[model samples]
Target chain A: MSTTVEMVRRPSSGAEQAPPSGALGRLRWAVVDGWVMTGRNMRHVIRSPEEIVLYFSLPIMFVLVFGYVFGSGMAVPGDGSYREFLLPGVFVMTMLYGLGATASQIAVDTGRGVVDRFRSLPMARSALLTGRAGADLLRALLELTVLVVCGLLVGWRWRNGVGDALAAVGLILLLRLAFTWLGILLGLLVPNPDTVSVIVFPFAFPLTALSNVFVAPELLPDWLGAIAAWNPLSATVAAARELFGNPGTGGESWAAQHALLLAVGWPVLLIAVLAPLAVRRYQRLSR
Target chain B: MTDETSAVVARGLRKTYGRTTALDGFDLTVPRGTVCGLLGPNGAGKTTALRVLTTLLRFDAGHARVAGHDVTRRPERVRAAIGLTGQYAAVDETLSGRQNLVLFGRLRHLPARMVRQRSDELLDQFGLTDVAGRSAATYSGGMRRRLDLAASLITTPEVLFLDEPTTGLDPRSRNGLWDAIRTLVTGGTTVLLTTQYLEEADQLADRISVVDAGRVVAEGTPAELKTRFGADRIELVVRHAGQLPAAAGLVERVTGGQVHVDRETRRLSAPVADRITALADLLRALQDASIAVEDVVLRRPTLDEAFLNITGHGASERTEVAA
Candidate 1:
């Protein structure tokens, strides 16, 4: 290289002294910055796929644990394939499991200065947050796909046609989106990434275990059953099971139709509760 | 570094975190085609002021215009006008240097072809051509820093904000950075820099502002601030440890100020306005008192001393902020 030009790593090259040139030009610049960060984040996930594998493995592992170990001894209060009854439970639990895992990603971003890097850039305020939500939702959808493939191999089949299968995936994706928002809210509210696991354990245990995903909603205790039926995860699982005839349980009722409404509603409610809070917390982060 | 216009201006800037103010009625003006250094020690609101200017943090009170647009009212426009290398970021460790620069170019909305071209150009310019394809995770601290700066320039911003551009670098890297900055300044780009290193300010800043406790205590050319706030440091290394007393007395007689001695170093030191002339008189008096002198040196007070005098604590010492 010639001697005229030297390498520089200064945070600012010469920005503080130059005059403003154009207005439209700068807005376009920020939009572009968002895409760059999005690509960077997605690439990071590609490099470290351990989280993806673990997330996908969870539902399949839960299915085996319950089907062979608990299925024969357990009854749905009727003669139905216990495998079919348990399948829906595992699927719903898989979707809800995304919440805490999503939080850990946000916490890591906060700790690693990735958030700080974007905060200092010319990118839009919503870009980074929106990008994170987008990435996590996609991750959840991928995890769902893997779990569905495993379910198919394990004698779980959807009776509904191609359209219904797409709709099932869509419903699960939407539910995961809601959970992801909740995860983001928690990540933002918490102080650091290290505390994320501690926070995650509490949310994971009850949200996954007490829902209709593992046992029949009716088998739960009088007080717990009512709460279990209301879990959005329960609604989603019931809807999917209604669409696909689970291994042996063939009870498709109006509850499946209502499950659609609940699946959509849960995310809306989560966004209602968490979106603004997350934005406000993010706004204060750079301070 | 194409010929660019004025990058930033902040007038009547004030910010308070709870009851403790971070920036108290601070004002700054940076003209086009020059490097303006925002020189200050720790906790002096330099970062706060930069944050406000970058549109990262909003001030409770004050009018700030970056790239000729109000920072609060038109943040995106300000962001468009400048590039912030960022105070605490390096490269995206997951990406190669070339990928990082290209990604930033794409984010700035450049055409895909142009992004590739710009990335290549930046890699060549920053001496990162060889490692352009390697992930930044494996790069040294200095290489990562260079890639970070390269990322910042993907848009060819008219203005730049560099906060402590060379704090932890070795001398060679620091000099390389200084040369790079000089080239940028020569080509008429605007720069705002904040640094604790006085020599960096003296070498690069068109003007220096000494900030302490969230206020600019002094602002001028390095020589001018030194003249106004700095006194000559008259130091005496005693011939023998016992001669420290006689040497201290002679210094007191010469300067009419109490001489201070560090018990550990066994040296006599005093402040005097005319360091060069005072040195001659001090040597003569010490000899007359038969006080042997091991060594003597007269110098202007360093910014460290000036910071202690102004802020009442060494800049290096950490003071807990009331959170």
Candidate 2:
């Protein structure tokens, strides 16, 4: 113990000087701190092999269940195969379910006092949240890559040109980015991490069921179809089907006809509204 | 006021949540390079005061300065100068111990080259070098706390805030933490510690501020606090319960203080000013009175008794529910 005390008595040789001043310096530090935090989160994902397996398995199971188990019984609105139509919906659905993961991770960090340490540090106030958004985006991209490969194995392909297919992938990621913000807000708002799944599942299930993920909105009843057509999830799925030239493109409703417009508009609107709310909630935590 | 001689100063800090007040008129001043202990039971606002000073939570009204910067207006400057280890160990459980320190160093704006070097140094100093590559989740409670403390020290802070650093640690680990804290103070770092253990405050703090119901009810050095409440006392147990009254009277006459008698225990006690002489005088008088004394001892008031005298309750009593 005396040796331990003697060791601690050594002077700290790497004491940091005060942070740089001025707006430019502050912005630079924000970016540096944000990147550091992002790396920290990425390490967690890499080290937890079991968590990665669990997260990826859900989307893979969904791909198998919807693509093969129900493909023969399901009907497509147009001439294309049902798996082609189902793949786009599955891609969009995976992004929507990702909201649960984002929320629970944030909640767990908050509960464990990690956020309190970050709040007390000299780092930029926006770094924690922006870092989370960055990490979630990267993880979402990985999920998309695996799902895309699985779709190919199940007889899904893009009839449209490569450029349109790439654009469709862009739209899917944009929706994911928006959902990331929503997850962050929900994570900060939840009282505990255990409750995030409870709230997220109830909310996400109804949303996916009401949208055109499993069936075209045109096949539903008049009122139910109108609600499904306008769902934010429907906008992204409908636009992706159009770009991929898959069957089950939505009917002539304004939301379906202008699928590309709504696809971009909905995510932009969600980011615009939810990002500020999440930031505000983070700033007021434990007040 | 941001004075050069003071590392921390708070005046009338007030914080409330809905109808509950967590801190009310909490005031403190800690001199530079000294340790000040905020001693209190649960729900006494010790953590709340720490949060306000560290700029983690806002107060409804108050003025506080840490390391010469206003806590509310110049929070970033305060944050740059201080480190906080919260009640819970805040290290990333998924990351290895070395990675946690490096992450905090980078976040604190240390040079990339220096970050790894500093982390290795900290891991060695904290006796965690042996397990530096293992994930923090696999570390024991004591190791995790040491890592948490090391993370806060990525750069030597001018002041450090430790909120109950040894709350759940075993006796050996608690002593190790105390020695580590002492080493930090010796190296010229001012520390503000909060704890529910009176002995911890007595052992490590240069001064202690006893808190109750969100305010500092008493403030002094450990010895001064004990003396302020009262001096040493002579307690004796009579051989027979029938002699308790006689023993009580004899103790009063010798000590010149009120004697408290307990018939059930056959014991009598009275405060004494001149401890040795009073003890000798009481013994001689009791012998002359033919009161059979089974046992006698002189004892000074513990901080627990002083706390009870000041707050009108024991130190372990929870006056209000709080986080």
Candidate 2 Cα errors over 4 Å, as ranges: A1-17, B1-4, B235-247, B261-268, B276-298
Instruction: Tell the DockQ for candidate 1.
Output: 0.24
Score residue A259 of candidate 2 by CA lDDT: 94
As for candidate 2, its clashing pairs are none
Report DockQ per prediction, comma-separated: 0.24, 0.50
C-alpha lDDT of candidate 2 relative to the true structure:
0.88
lDDT of 2 by residue, A69-175 (tens): 98778887867788888999999999999989899888888778877888888899889888888898889889989998999999889889999999999999999
Candidate 2's fnat? 0.59
Q: What would the per-residue lDDT of candidate 2 be over residues B73-103, giving only the tens digit for each residue?
A: 8998998889899789998898999989988
Task: Give the local distance difference test score of model 1.
Answer: 0.71
Top-DockQ candidate index:
2
Give me the displacement of residue B286 in model 2, in angstroms: 5.9
In the order shown, the chain A TM-scores of the predictions are 0.82, 0.92
